[model samples]
Target: MSSEIRQLEPKQLWNKFADLNAVPRPSKKEERVIKFMKDFGVGLGLETIEDEVGNVIIKKPATLGMEDRKTIVMQSHLDMVHQKNNDTVFDFDTQGIDMYVDGDWVRANGTTLGADNGLGVATIMAILECTDIVHPAIEALFTIDEETGMTGAMGLKGGLLNGEILLNLDTEEDDEIGVGCAGGIDVTAIRSYDQEETPESKIGYKIVVKGLQGGHSGMQIHEGLGNANKIMNRLLFDGFENFGLRISEIDGGSLRNAVPRESNAIVAIDAIQEEAFILEINDLANDIKTEYKTMEPDMVIEVSETETPDQIMDLGVQEGLTRAIYAALNGVYRMSADIPNLVETSNNIARVIVKDGHVKIGCLTRSSVETSKWDLANMLRATFELTGCEVEFGGDYPGWKPNMDSDILKVMVPLYKNLNNGETPHVAACHAGLECGILGTNYPEMDMISFGPNIKGAHSPDERAQISSAQKYWTYVLEILKNIPKK
Candidate 1:
């Protein structure tokens, strides 16, 4: 056993986490992690089961003197969003996450730490394996493919979960209990174009945007971070007018739910204007960066030489892509008038790709209200249609509606306040999607509330969880577990 894998508090739980991290468990590729979890439960003599969709459930009998307590379900997703820096070469399917301790916090080197839900998993595993902590009959529910789609949660049938109370351990802010979350839908646009060889008189230049703090679109949308794709498109449109260049290829952003931190484009320009064009772009980059420096101080725009200057997009194709991109919706569409701090609707132009004569654009639209979601989708679809491109809306999950008088909230808020020295924890709705939304529809009677430690930069490389907050969260969670009411 590696020293890094040595057990921490709740050895069985952290051991399972360390062991699970050793295996690759990116979304849709969580078989090894799933199997390992089930086997771990079996070795501990607990009842374990796997659903057809790869979700896992482990049931542990009530601890001594707790059989009379109501059964509580602890839930978190097993799959993680696989992301890494451009300089890193680790593979998600083959490489274990390189984790290390920084003072009091634990994080992965150059990648997502997976502490998002892994902590929840470890906590649940600890409770089940201890045969010690006095608590209710517990069910540890692990769902799969939650990052890309809530397939596991969506497919859950009635009676799968026997627990009447659920504690969701996926919120980022430690002191804020997530009572609701925005529903979301994926929107994609595609346009087919004929290719044409570039005229020999043209020059090629690579336009690059770098050094922005891209974060989870839902969590950080209101943070004022720059979207690389949007900024790049703005520059490209400006360049085309001045230099009469044809875009050969443009690509940016990694995930549909993350803010784009960097982007690059290949353009063919008139050989005579190449030098002047590069200079102009460099200047524009700095100007744009200055404009957004309060939020994106690290932003850099560079126009550099490329190996070949011969490749070029067809004139009409270039126009279609540029127009569609310029017109596509990006940034917060609406702010909540009711909730002072809430963002009611927003869209992130999350990904852009050019391949096989097709340039595809991907965006994720979010809204707490169903009408707002559809309204944003309609705006995107209309923008694409205006550019003569085809657009499609992916299947969307419903939002978790906030119930102020919810039974779960009634129980958790008091526990939270008492644990924090009479500090009343904030009650807020998340713009991000949570399993509660899907689980509500699947199991009508289930009541859910999400709470967790203070985790920053979720879904991005800068992600980190606060040490003090974790201890507080654990303390509060334990209290909630012991006091949940029975029917």
Candidate 2:
């Protein structure tokens, strides 16, 4: 099936994508990909260095007369978020992504296509391995663990790269030139609870919240797609209120970055209210579906009877857990006053698990403004603390502040216009977390910009990349490389 992906036009880029995806490069688990990259750089006989924290840097001298141009950094993370559908059986650790050609797009079979950064990685790899492309000195940077925490970027030391400008090929929309991006922090809440013996009168059932269109929590946070954890909590809250339902175990969502798509809970309820519970839940599910019909047309909320559990969460803890999740924020918090149609601050209640006398809740908060980032974080911390959960904040990274006066922007804007029937590209900041910000700390003077092909449903199983857009973007990359400013 991956052979189909290799056949896409611009074989240089698609072939590299297929090769990269053939290796398992999940975040925080990139040993194989790291080796692959090192071998690639060495194979080309270029100056290659694998930093202490696992970032690979491959440098190539300027080709032909382009030596007069400024050196540039081409960066994309080597890692991809590992996500799959509930009904799909795939091992992200051992097997390569099974991809197929779908109309004008390329997609994985029931799994994330890894186009977010893989496409970017492929683009750079194509150029690095090329013999005819006219470009300035290239510094190919491949970072690890970008999907989960960005630890690779944080751990990178200074004085390593000689480039004066950076061209980040990680932006999703081909028509947009990204000048800025949001920073993020991880919010985790944990606590202990006592499980009580299930009442003799209680019977068990399974509640599944699926079919929601989950996506990149940051890029699509403003789209109003449903969050599975929030939807599941709503169902549990209503059931407990009406039927004195007791929770035995609940597991919702997967990664903290991808908006949750599926959630399932095991619960026990008083048998006397079984008939009423089914009717009430079905009606509520229908109401929820109606509320999101346009955004999540395929959303399905179902409850089915299941084997009984031996224990249920303490009534007090159960009540607190539901209330805290209900109170927590899960979508866009503020729009940028500085930029039109930009999400300035937001939160994704990304994951939730309540089981075995323990509770864990994970969230990712993003904001371009430093103060606003913590403001929303404290909001989540306070909300969960109300439920006696000790919350911790980690993986803090800074946002990329937009430079309207950027020299690279000036070069890219007019070039993009000439490339597209004189149509101007959208010059703006995005809500998604890009490594441009983190990479800037050590090289403050480096002018940076990001752009890429159109990738939809990123961070979710429905992820796909456009074939035509990739060709268009490929042309842009070639032109940009030829036009790097003189040193």
Model 1 TM-score relative to the real fold: 0.96
Model 1 stretches with alpha carbons more than 4 Å out = 1-16
Off by over 4 Å in 2: none
Model 2 lDDT vs. the true structure?
A: 0.94
Model 1, span 1-487: residue lDDT tens? 2245444443454565676678788888899989978997898898899998999999987777778877888999988878787667888889887887666666778888777777777777777777557788888899998888889899887787889878888998887998899899999988877777778887778888987888889989988899999999989898998989778888899888889988988887788997888788878887898899999887888887775545566677778778888887788899887777898899999998864478889999999989999999999999887877789999598999887887878988888878778889899998988999899997777778898887787787777656666767777877887787865
Which lDDT value does model 1 have at 87?
A: 69
TM-score each candidate: 0.96, 0.99
Error of 1 at 262 (Å): 1.9
